[model samples]
Target: MILSIKNKTLAAITLLSVISVSVFADDNQLTAQEKADGWQLLFDGTDMSQWRSFKQPTVNEKWQIEDGAITLTAGGGGDLISKKTYKNFELTLDWKIAEAGNSGILILADEKGKYIYSHAPEIQILDNERHPDNKLDTHLSGSLYDLIASPIASHKKAGQWNSTKIRLENSALTVWQNDVQTAKVTIGSDEWNSLIAKSKFASWPDFAAAKEGHLGLQDHGDKVWFKNIKIKELN
Candidate 1:
């Protein structure tokens, strides 16, 4: 077909647009890698159906859904807990700490948010220089709570977003901040056994056994926000 230069240009642009959208369509969907591994979105920017308060059963307190993300509207009173319990999985989430200094916990194997089962440990969040726990464990922002503080310092400025990841296997646990490995521990291993023998949890049943459990975000009475929280179960 004979076409004017303007028409030719328009057609070319249209074709390019089509190609771009086609690429986007494929890219927008879950990638083959993600699909093959079967990862699901726990929060998609507008709901908290997948989460609840550790202290509340049917009602979610202070945890708000906004901008396609899950966030803590206010800190304190209670913590956010994953609606679905998990075991032997990898977890990833984004978080930010607000002013006034607060803390949160990535706790696992919690029984109704009471305490960490043998399988549950915490990746504590705090304002290193300004928070009390920071003194207890200067690795503060990314520490394995009291059990094992962050191997190194890692705390972003308040109000800035930070990414965190945790992996829990049959007996091994690893934690990452941004992209650096900050903590690693093996449950029931010699180290764990040694600690358990003298620690408070030593008497608890299933203290280090691989089992089903929930993910908990501790309430430290300050403003702490979280988003992009997801978990992938490992066979």
Candidate 2:
């Protein structure tokens, strides 16, 4: 049957609305452009199937999905690591920590030492304004945890979500927190070696030794939430 003019206009409007929603997809869903660039979601907010407890085959009970975020409710959950490992890549995520809480995003993490941090370089996650860790610049949010300090403070306050972007390509590493450039370094370079020589990692012989490994989220005995975790592997 032929449609009336008014019906045709309404149908066109509905089609436009659908297209708009598709263009501006919600969190945890990749847009078409991202998918084309090889971006993959690690946590789409529904489950933790993409991650497991560090060095283990499963996730722990304390890490739960709440309000579409992977939240660490209490102690004993251990660190969570991605099922797949990556080398050169770009990773983005949103996180929020409780008051005085602490956590971290571990890169090139492997089970070569007694603890995950012993082998992995970390981008720290902390409530900078309230945590005791705030006393040191290297311990603040977005820092290369004790090895390098974030040039500026850009993290949102506790309970507020902060966006983080990390890219490691061709031995060069860069990080952005909330759109502000936080850290930049070239792995295994003279500068990087000097930084590690003075930091706590100097005692850990295998720190940052892996060229490819799993992405990790630290437990840190505190409550923290993460979402919109996505990564794009590079050549």
Candidate 3:
């Protein structure tokens, strides 16, 4: 069912994201040939060359690279984001809690200090059974942060890596957990727009209106590890 909704949502936002992407292009960097070739690694498993902390009014003191993975350390704050702002792209990464009582998030469609969930929707990563942050509508691992909830239960043991795939085409968003689509969402729909209008993004410029933006990894600071990050730039 989740996969079905994801496909349908992609169909709905295909036109919107494409049109918006063209409008938002900083440069015509990716040619048709590039899209035809194959996938690209956003994170080569050994470097932090492609990501940085979220700008202004935020901090990520807990992020570190260990054993080829981005791991969370003590006192980490805020989120880490891609240096390359994207209009549309497919992203893959893996994450897991270090303990049975922790949580984190994988964010997309971001535009700076606006409400975290309102501007940058996140895929929740948590130990559902024991995490201190566990909650139904918005706190479960694999959720769309606060916008959409995961229909299935995912409680990968603490300290065990779990995978996630996220694809965002302008307003269209899809998420997969352990190779299964877990949540699908379309922004700018009447329903999505309504939610946007009532949230912090309503008064924030380019909050959720962006065509291209960064991919963010949130640090909720309870010990999480991330690796195998990659992406295939889309046209």
Instruction: Please tell me which predicted candidate would have the highest TM-score against the true structure.
Output: 2
Off by over 4 Å in 3: 1-36, 56-62, 100-103, 106-118, 153-155, 194-207
Q: Which ten residues in a row have the lowest lDDT in candidate 2?
A: 147-156
TM-score of each: 0.76, 0.91, 0.71
> For model 3, what is the C-alpha lDDT against the true structure?
0.66
- Give lDDT tens digits, candidate 1, residues 1-235: 5568889999999999887764432311333455567666666666667777664674355666555445567655476668887778888778878765666555555653254333456677766667665666633778765566665546677778788988888868888887878878787689877766765556666654545677777666676777777667898
Query: Residue-wise lDDT of candidate 3 within 138-167, one digit each (tens)?
Result: 567777665566666554666777888888
TM-score of 1: 0.76
Which has the greatest lDDT? 2
Question: What are the clashing pairs of model 3?
Answer: 61-76, 61-77, 62-76, 86-212, 124-142
Candidate 1 structure lDDT: 0.67
Q: Which lDDT values do the candidates have, in the order given?
A: 0.67, 0.90, 0.66
- Give me candidate 2's TM-score against the actual structure: 0.91
Residues 112-212, model 2: lDDT tens digits = 67788878999999988888889889999999899777766586789999999999998799999999898899999999999989998888887888889
Separately for all candidates shown, the number of backbone clashes (residues 3 or more apart, or on different chains) is: 4, 0, 5
Q: Is candidate 2 or candidate 3 better by lDDT?
A: 2
lDDT of 2 at 174: 96
Question: Candidate 1 — which residues are off by over 4 angstroms?
Answer: 1-32, 112-119, 196-210
